[model samples]
Target: MATFQKGILGGFSGKVGNVVGARWRGKNVMRSLPQRGSYTATAKQEEQRLKFKTVIGFLSPLVDILNRYFGSPQGDKSRANLATSYHLKNAVVNLPTGTVMDYAKVLISKGDLRGIDGGTVAAAAAQTLNFGWQDNSGQGKATATDELMVVVYAPELNLFYTNVAVATRDATTASVTLPNFMASLEVEVWASFSKPETNFAAISTYMGAVTVL
Candidate 1:
């Protein structure tokens, strides 16, 4: 009976060992199955985050460069002072009564005054003046007879209206003769009408070459 009992005990132990081994192998196989979908999602999210960061980094530098070129903060005032000329063919004309006058085309030219040489003026001093003088009852007809004043400013030399001229009337056209400003210098122009018109128009003038010392 003792021998029988010993054999039975050995058999039961063997069966238990086999069952445990099989369950362990099955658990490992399940664990090994691909988690590819989860991995792909994670990778995509990381890529998008990196791309967004890169774009933001590039834009930050670009904005800084633009600000520098455009003279932001303290630089703007200094840069404005250095500008050669602030061309003003499209300048708004204000009347004494606080009403805005309509602008017509105006032109400007640079060179020495007629018969004068060696000195130059801004080039192409020509523009048109537009105005309507008549009220609803035809009381006033638009007139181009009023003299137009051309004033020029040069910041480099601290000059104001160093060169001035008047526009000549030609029917509906008006033109001013400009003298060669100091060579190689930037200059600003301003215009005023002797009388105001009811309407305004666009005008342009060419700047003259600056002489370099």
Candidate 2:
């Protein structure tokens, strides 16, 4: 039986050789198999090819959308409220007697008077009259006899007020009458130097104002 099986296998090998010799060299042997419609790639290779194509297609549309949404955009940040600074300048003390009494200048910077609550006299004390008063004799003196009266004018409010006096006696006098000079918002200061019969010459001078931004 072993010999018979060996003989049969040898005959099969010979038959395969004969079929191959009937065809031309290098011709596809697979073409003789029954046709199963069409050839298709394995599942893994097909999935990999699909992923590669998807990646390539995504790039152009992604760039176009980003450019349309974010490129060369306009901004309205210029309309914001701006920081500003102001200082007192050349304040002239116009006495009721028609005489321009004295002139003084004020220096104002942001940090000089920090944490001052708005709309109060003490809040604005950092900007005060620089000394040297003009007396009734028209002499510039370093000191005044009574108090210094200042007339404040606020340009933004278009108003003027009178008798915002700085007392010479008390360095810390912090109260004053709110002036009713103008309907517009403004600030003015004045000092009183004498009582009736006091021969202390009335002085007037300019108190300066300034602003910084």
Candidate 3:
């Protein structure tokens, strides 16, 4: 198969010995076809590939924030790439489950002082929910300031409410006001903490699965 541009002069195709003609990405191109052989990867290889993909997709959008907070790897030019690769390799993807990441664990491994402890949730109002956690200022970790990401999933409506930056971890409790459009159903809340100066975001854990009163 040959890929051609929108207004290419002519079409090109047919296999010329090892090379095959094909059109790709708005241009005419040719490349060598695969040799006759089994193209399947081993089980372990597939598993690793999937893991890499999951990490990449999750962290790609936060490259700048990660680099800024985590700081650059010593003597390395590509700070964003460095953080991404390091976390992807050292991340424990099996803590909460084999496939899903236990969010706080990843952050702690990277450089967080510690994961939020004793996280508690309660309904503050008809549309507001409050979250509180033990202040880790006593830990004396590298970070002095904290931030949070709150994710709420409503199973009854199959909806998700995500607030990437709820607030700085200055206070012990943070409140989240949900949209009125969401169904009044039992919702599961997950939380992750990050330092203000570093990219270390703790692994997110389930806060609770409760119905708002």
Each prediction's whole-model lDDT (CA): 0.30, 0.31, 0.64
lDDT of 1 by residue, 60-131 (tens): 322322222222234445322211121121222334453221222212222111211121233342322122
Would you give me the overall lDDT of model 1?
Answer: 0.30
Error of 2 at 15 (Å): 99
What would the TM-score be for candidate 1 when compared with the true structure? 0.25
Measured by TM-score, the strongest candidate is 3
TM-score of each: 0.25, 0.24, 0.52
lDDT per residue (tens digit) for residues 46-139 in model 2: 6545444433332222232222221132353110100000110132223345323122332111111111111123222333423333233222
Off by over 4 Å in 3: 1-111, 140-144, 156-158
The 10-residue segment of model 3 with minimum total lDDT is 101-110
lDDT of 3 by residue, 1-213 (tens): 444454555756668788787666657777878879879999778777777876776666555555654544676456567666666676537333455443433431234446678888887557688898877765655243667777776655655677767876657788898878653667777776776545556645567676765
C-alpha RMSD of candidate 1: 28.8
Cα error of candidate 2 at position 97, Å: 30
Predictions ranked by TM-score, top down? Answer: 3, 1, 2
Q: Between candidates 1 and 3, which one is better according to lDDT?
A: 3
Q: Considering summed lDDT, which 10 consecutive residues are worst modelled in model 1?
A: 110-119
